[model samples]
Target: MKDLRLIFRYSKPYLRDLIIAVGLLIIECAFEMIIPVLMSTLIDEGVPAHDMPVILRQGGLMVVCAVLALVTGLLYARFAARYANGFAAELRLAEYAAVQKFDFANLDHFSTASLVTRMTTDATVLLNAVNTGLRPLVRSPVMLFMGLGMAFILSPRLTIIFLVATPILAAMLAWIVSKVAPLYGRQQSAVDHLNSRIQEGLTAIRVIKAFVRGDWENQQFDEVNTELSDASTETFRFAVLNMPSFQTVMYTCIVCIMWFGGNFILTGNMSVGQLTAFLSYVLQVLNSVMMFSGVFLQMTRSLASARRIREVLTEQPDLANADQPVTEIENGAIDFENVSFKYNAGAEKNALSDITLHIPAGATVGIIGGTGSAKTTLVQLIPRLYDATAGTVRVGGRDVRDYDLAALRDAVGIVLQKNLLFSGTIRDNLKWGSPDATDDQIWAACRAARADEFLDRMPDGLDTDLGQGGVNVSGGQKQRLCIARTLLKHPKVLIFDDSTSAVDTATESGIRHALAQLTDVTKLIIAQRISSVQSADLIVILDDGRLHAVGTHAELLAHDTIYQEIYQSQKKGGDPQ
Candidate 1:
C-alpha cells in the first residue's frame, strides 16, 4: 500500500477526471441494483394480480434505469481511460527525466534494459490495472452495502447468511493475496530479465552473426523465455484458484437460501415478492464480492509495478548542481590536484590514484597508457562525468562543482572511443553539437575532421541518412563524422579518447594537423599509438593507474625508461617491453 501511494501521486493532476469517473460509476451501480428489485416486482406482484397497467409501468421504469446505467457506465469508461492513460504518460515522462539526471555512477546502478522495462512494461501494467480496477473499486463497496441493506429489509434471516459467509470469504481472499503478491514481483523480474536478453541480442546481432553464435544465442533466449513462462504460469495458477473458491461459496449460499426461503414462503412466513427480492439482493452482494476478487488480482500485479516505479522516482542522482553555480567558463585550462577516483567506493584499488597534472589554456597534451591505465577516466573528470572521490578537479580555474553542469559540459567537447550516431541525416547528426550551426560552419568542421572528403564522394553528401547507430558508414568514417560533430561546438577544450583509432595513420595525421590550427582551443589526445601524440607539447605516461612520467616526446625518450621502451618498440615494429 505504501508503494501504491507513489502511483496515486502521479494521478493528482487528473483528479477532476478521477472524481467524475468514480461518481458516474456509483450512479451506474445504483441503477444496476434497481433492475433486480424491479424484476422481482414484475414477477410477484404484476403477474399475480393480473395488473396490466402495473406491469407496463414497472417494465418502462426498468428500461429507463437500464438506459441510464448504460449511459453513465459509458461516461465512466471514458473518464477512466483518460485518467489512466494520462497518469501513465506522466509517470513515463517523469521516469525518463529522472534517468536523464543520473550521473555515470547512478546509471551503473541500474542496467539500461531494466530501466526500459520500468518505463514501458511496468508502466503499461499499472495503466491496465488502473483502467480495469477503477470502476469495480468504486462500485463494489456501494453495491455490497446497498444490496445488504435491501436484503435485510426483505428478510433479516436470509441476510444472516451473508454475515456468516463474509468472514470466511475474506479470509480466503487474504490468503490468496498473500501468496500471489510475492509471485507477481518475481514475474516482473523475469520480464526484466527477458527484455534484457532481447535488447542485448538485438544490439549485438552483427557480432553474434560474425562469431557464428546464432545457435548459442537462440538457446540463451530459450532459457530466459522458459523462465518467464514458468513464472507467469506459476503466478496465474495461484490466481485462478480464487474464482473457483469464490463461485463455490457463492453457489452454496444460493442453494441454502432457496431451500430455506421456499419453506418460509410455503409456511406463509414470507411473501413470494419478498423472497424474490431477497434472492436478487443476495446475488448482488455475492457478485460484488466476486468483482472485488478481480480487483484484488489486478492490484496485486500493479503493486509490483508500483514498487519498481517508486524506486526510480525516489532515487536522488549522485551528481547535482551547486547552489551558486558559475554559468561561464573563462578558459580551457584544467587542473587535477592529487585526484583519486574509484568506480565503486568499496573497490580495493582506485581507477586513478593521486593524479596531478595541469594543462594551459591553449597547450596540446598527449596521454599514453596501457589498456587498464585509466586514460579515459582522467579526461572524463574535466567535464565532471564522474567526480573525484578524494581531491579536486578544476576547469577554467574554478572547481567543476561550482559551474552549472550544462555550461561546464558545453565548454568541453569529447569524442569517445565507441562513436555513436543516431538515425538521421549526416547534417542532422552534426547539428546536435550546435543546433543552429550554418551550412558553412558544418562544412568547415567536417573539413577539419577529414570527414568532408568522404561526404563529397557520397551521393547525397550531408543529406544522406545514417541508419541506426550509423551502421551505413564504415568504422573510420563514423569516428571522423563524430569528430566533425564535436568540432561544430567550437568548445574551449576538445578531447579525443582514442576516437581516431579506426582511421589509417595518414588520415589520422591529417586530422591532427588540422586540429593544430585551432591554436586557442586546448587539446587532449589519448591514444595507444606513440606516433599519435609524439608531437604534443607534453606527453603524460601512465602505468597501473598512476602517473609514471610527464614530458615532451624527445624529453621522455631521453629520460624515461617506460617512454623510451614504447618509442623504440614502435620504431622497431615490435610490441612494447
Candidate 2:
C-alpha cells in the first residue's frame, strides 16, 4: 500500500470526477438494494393482499428507481472511463520524460522492452484497476453494511446467524490475498522478461536468420512465454479459490436464515413481509460480497503494477544539477584534468585512467588507438555523457558539468561511430542539426562533407525519402550525411568518431581537405586509418586507455615505436599513398 501512495498523487487532479463517480455509485447501489426489497414487498404484501392501488404505486416507484440507477451508473461509467484514459496518457508522458532525463549510463541499465512495459502495460493495469475497481470497492462495502442493518432491523436472531459466517469467510479471503499478492508480483515480472525476449528477437531477426537460428530463437521465446503462462495460472488458481469458498459460506448462511425466519413467520413472532424482506437483504449482502471478491483480485494486480511503476519513478538520475547550478559555456577547447572513469564502480580497472590532455581552440587533433584503448571514452568525457570518477572534464574552459546538458552538447557536435539517419526526407534528417537553416546553408554544409555529389544524383535530392537508419543509402553516403548534418550546426568544437571509415580513400581525402578549411572551430578526429592522422596538427596515440605518444607525424615517426610499425605497414600496403 505504501508503494502505491504515489498513485493517489497523480490521481488527485481528478477529485471532482472521482467524487461524481462515487456519488453515482452510491445511488446505483441504493437502487439495486431497493429492487430486492420491492420484490419482497410485492410478494408478501401488495400481491397477497389483493390491493391494486398498492401494487400499482410500488411498481411505479420501482420503475423510477431503476431508471435513475441505470442513468447514474451509465454516467459514472462514462466519466470514469474517460478520466482514467486521460490519466494514463499523462502518466505515460511523465514516465517518458523521466526516462529521457537519465544519462546514457543509467538508461543502459534497463532494456527498451522493460521501459516500454513500465510506460504502457504497467500504467494500463493500474488505470483499469482505478476505474473498474472504484465502483465495486466503494459501492459493495456500503451495500453490505446497509443490507446487514436492514436485516437486523427486521430480525436480530437471523442477522446473528449470517454474521457468524462472515469472520470465517473473511479469514479465508485474507489467506488467499496474502498467497496471491506475491504471485501477482511474480507474474508481472515474468511478463517483463517475456516482453524483453520478444523485443530482442524482433530487433535481431536479421542476425537470427543469418545464423540460421530461427528454431533456436523460437524455443527461447517459448521458454519465456511458458514461464509467464505458469506464473499467471498460479496466481489465477489462488484468486479463484476465494469465489467458491465464499459462495459455500453464503449458501450456509442462506439456509440458516430460511430455517429461523420461516419458523418465526409461522409462529406469528414476525410478519410474512418482514421475513421476505430479511431473506432478500441476506441475498443482497451476499451479492455485494461477491462483487468485492472481484475488486480484491483487481486490487492485487494493480498493486503489483504500481510497485513496478514506482521502481522506475523512484530511480535517481545519473546526472543532476548542483545546489546552485551554473548555466554557461565560456570556451570551446576541452581539457581532461587527471580524469579517471570506470563504467561501473567496483569494476576491475578504469576505462580511462588519470588521463590529462588539452586542445586549444581552432586546432585539429587526431586520436589514434587500438580497439578498447578508451579513445571513445575520452572523447565522451568532453560532452559529459558520463562524469569522471575522480577528476574534472572542462569544456569551453569551464568544468563541463557547469554547463547545462543542452548548452554543452550544442557547443560540441559529435558524429557518433554508428551514424543513424531517421526515416524521413533527406532535408528533414539534415535539418535536425540546424532546424532554422536556409536551403543555401543546407547545400553548403552538404558540400563541405562531400555529400552534395550524391545528393544531386538522387531523384528528389533533399526531399528523397530515406529508409530506416538510411539503409537505402550506401554506408559511405550515410556517414557523409551524418558529417554534413553535424557541420550545419556550426558548433565551436566538432568530433568525428571514426565517422569516415565507410568512405574510400579518395573521398576520405576530400573530407580531410574540407576540414582543413575550417577557420575557427576546434576539431577532434578519432580514426583507425593512419592516413587520417598523418597531417593533423597533433596526433595522440593511445594504448590500453593510456597515452603512449603525442606528436606531429614527423615527430612521431622519429620517436614513437608503435607509430613506426603503423607507418611501415601502411607504406608497404601503399594504401594511404
Candidate 3:
C-alpha cells in the first residue's frame, strides 16, 4: 500500500488526463448497458406482434448506442495512452534526477546494475501496467455490478447463479495472485544479476581475451540466463491457471441459468426475450470477472517494480550543503585536526586515524605511503568527498563542512589514480574543467602536462575522437590528458594521487617543473618513488593508517627509518618493502 501511494503521487501531475479518460469510459459503459435492454424490447413486442414500426424503432436505437459506445471507447483509449506515456516520462526523469544527487556513501548502498534496472526495466513494467489498468480497471467493476442488477430485474431466480459463482472465481484469482507476486520480485532481481555480469564482462573484455577465458565467461553467463528463464516460467505457470479456472466457473453458471431459466419461461413467469436478455447480462458479468483477473495479474508485477523505484526515490543523500554556506574559498591552505575516518561505520578498523597536519597557502607537500596507508583517503577529505569520522578538515581557513559543496569542489582540483575520458573529441573532454575555456587555454594546459607531444602527431590534433575511455590512446597519453584537463580548471589547490605512475621519469619531471611555475597554487602529490617527492618543501611519511614522519626529504632520509628504507630500496632498483 505504501509503495502504491508513491506511484499515485507521481501520477498526480497528469490528473486532468486521468479524469477525462475515466469519464469517457463511464459513458461508454452506460451506452453498452442500454443495448441489451433495447434488444429485449424488440424481441418481446415487435417480433411476436409482427409490428415493423416497433422493430425498426428499437433496432435503430441499438445501432445508435453501439456507435456512440465505439466513439467514446476510442477517445478513452487516446486519453489513457497520453496519461500513461506522460506519467512514465516524468517518473523516469524524477528517478534519474534523484540518482544524480547521491553521494559516494549513497552510491555504495545500491549496486550500479540494480539502479539501472529500476530506471529501465522496472519503469517499463509500470508503464504497461498503468496503460492496461486505466481502461479495464475502471470499466470492469462498473460493468459487473450493472450487469448483475439488470439480470436481477429480468428474473431474480436466474440471478442466484451469479451470486454463487462470483465468490468462487474471486477466491481462485486471489490464490493465483498470492502464488505469483513474490516470483515477479525474484525475477527482477535475476535480471539485475544478469545485467551486472554482462557489464563486468564488457568493461574487462580486454583482460578476459588476453587470458583466453571466453569459454569460462560464456558458461557463467549461461548459468544466470537459465536462472532468469526458469523464474519467468514459474511465474507464468501460476498466472496461466487464472483463465481456465474462471472459464470453468463462468460455464457452470451459464448451465445453471439455462436449466432453471427454461422452467421460468415455461410457467409463463418470463418471456423468451427476457430469458435471452438475462443470459446476455450473465455473460457480461462473468466476462467482467475474467477481465478483472487479468488486471490483477499485471498489478502483481507492477507492485514489485513500484517498491524498487520507491527505494531510490526515498533515499537521502549522505552529503548536502550547509544551511548558511561560505560561497568562496579564501586561499589554498588546508588543515586537518585530529582527523580520523572509516569507509563503513561498523567496520573494525579506521582507514585513517588521528592525523593532525597543515600545509601553508601555496606550499608544495609530498605524501609517500605504503598500500592501505590512506594516502588517497586523506586527500579526499580536503574536498569533503568523505567527511572525517572523528575531527575536522579545514580548507582555506574554514571548516570544509561550512562551505557550499560546489564552491569547495571548484577550489580543489584532483587528477585521480584511475583517470577516465568520455566518448567525444579531445577538446570536448578538456572542457569539463572549464566549460568556457578558449582553445588557447586548452593548448597551454596541454603543453604544461606534456600531452601535446602525441597530439602534434595525430591528424585531427585537438579535434580527434577519444573513443570510449580513451581506448585509442596509450596509457601514458591518457594520464597526461587527464592532468591537462585538471590544469585547465586553474584551481587554487591541486592534488595528484599517483597520477604520473604510467609516464616515463623524464616526462614526469617535465610535468612537475611546469606545475612549479604556478607559484600561487598549492600542490600535494602522492607517490611511491622517493625521487618524485625529494624536492618538495615538505614530505610526509605514512605507515598503515598513521602518519609516521613529516619533514623535508633530506631530514626524513636522516631521521625516519621507514623513509630511509623506501629511499634506499628505490635507489637500488628494487620494489619498496
Prediction 1 TM-score vs. true: 0.97
- Supply the global lDDT for candidate 3: 0.91
Please, what are the lDDT tens digits per residue for candidate 3 over residues 25-101? 99998998898899999999999999999999999999999999999999999999989988898889989999998
**Residue range 1-577, candidate 2, lDDT tens digits:** 9867876667666768888888888888888778767766776778888988878888888898899889999999987876677677777877888888888787877878888898988998988887778877887788888898888887888889867888887898889999998998888888889999998898788899999999999999999999999998999999989889988998988888788878898888887778878878888788778778878878888988888888777778888766665666665777878889999988999888888888888889999988999999889888788889988988778887777778788888999999899999899999999999999999999999999989999999999999876878998999999999999999888999999999989889999899999968888999988898789998999889887888999999999999999888878998666
Per-residue lDDT of 245-300 in model 1, one digit per residue for the tens? 99999999999999999999999988887887888888878888898888998899
What is the C-alpha local distance difference test score of candidate 1?
0.91
Model 1 spans with C-alpha error above 4 angstroms: 574-577
Distance from true location, Cα of 196 in model 2, Å: 2.0
- TM-score-based ranking, best first? 1, 3, 2
lDDT of each: 0.91, 0.86, 0.91
Q: In model 3, which regions exceed 4 Å deviation?
A: 49-53, 574-577
> What pairs collide in candidate 1?
none
Candidates' TM-scores? 0.97, 0.94, 0.95
